[model samples]
Target: MAAENIEQENSKVKYLRDKLEKAILEKCPDSRLNGDKENRLPNTTNISFEYIEGEAILLMLDKYGICASSGS
Candidate 1:
């Protein structure tokens, strides 16, 4: 039962991750996803947008109550 619950949780995470990735790519054609798509953690997504500073993007997201981080 515990294993089943864990599997379900993982599936949910993967589903949400994929959905988010799809939405971002659709909205921003110049953006690119970082790291391995299939091998990375299910809950983590790294995307880079062209012609925009990463810090600026994070700040804008924060204004909308979105929590994001930068590696720089």
Candidate 2:
């Protein structure tokens, strides 16, 4: 069976991404954002939390219904 695809762009994704990036930059001084703001994947946000465990952060975010993954 062929995979179904949607052609429409989800503007909501960009809107939410912008909001999240703004919030993180403003509030999380220890976070190191992993991409150039001017040239970044719209659907990907990678951050490294200095002095914090990635797994711990992921677990906390999961409790809040934010789906995230780590390479470490």
Candidate 3:
């Protein structure tokens, strides 16, 4: 059961990441993805929006119930 649960969660994370990546690339072209997509943790993503402050992004994401770190 534990292994199955892990697989399920990984699937969800992959889906979310793919969606987020597409959305950002299409709607926010100025934004940047921090690491190599082919060589990163399954459940971790880092994006840097151009010409924006980290705190501002954090606050907006927080309002939408998305928890993120600034990596400061």
Candidate 4:
């Protein structure tokens, strides 16, 4: 039962992550998702935007209470 619940929760997270990725790509055509599409952690997303400073993006997201990490 516990394993089933964990699997279900993981599926939900993966679905949401895919949706978010689609939205991000739609809004920012210059952005690209990093890492493997099918073999990545269900809860994490890494996206690289062309011509944007990572720190600046992080600061803007922070203003809206969004927590994000950058590798730049």
Best by TM-score: 4
What ordering of candidates by lDDT runs from best to worst?
4, 1, 3, 2
Can you give the TM-score per candidate against the true fold?
A: 0.88, 0.74, 0.81, 0.91
* Per-residue accuracy of model 3 over 1-72 as CA lDDT, tens digit each: 878699788888888887888898789978878779787767788888888898998899899998988984
Each candidate: RMSD:
1.8, 3.6, 1.7, 1.7
Model 4: colliding residue pairs: none
Candidate 1 CA-lDDT value: 0.90
1-72 per-residue lDDT for model 4 (tens digits): 878699889999999999999999999999999889999889999999999999999999999998998963
Return model 3's CA RMSD, one decimal.
Answer: 1.7
Q: Please report the candidate that would top lDDT against the real structure.
A: 4
> Worst lDDT window (10 residues) for model 3?
37-46
Q: Rate the local accuracy (lDDT) of all candidates.
A: 0.90, 0.76, 0.84, 0.94
lDDT assessment of candidate 4: 0.94
lDDT winner, 2 or 4: 4
Model 2 residue runs over 4 Å out of place are: 1-10
lDDT of 1 by residue, 16-51 (tens): 999999999999999999988889888889999999
Model 2 lDDT tens row, 1-72: 223332234355667788897798789898877868767656677777888898999899999998988783
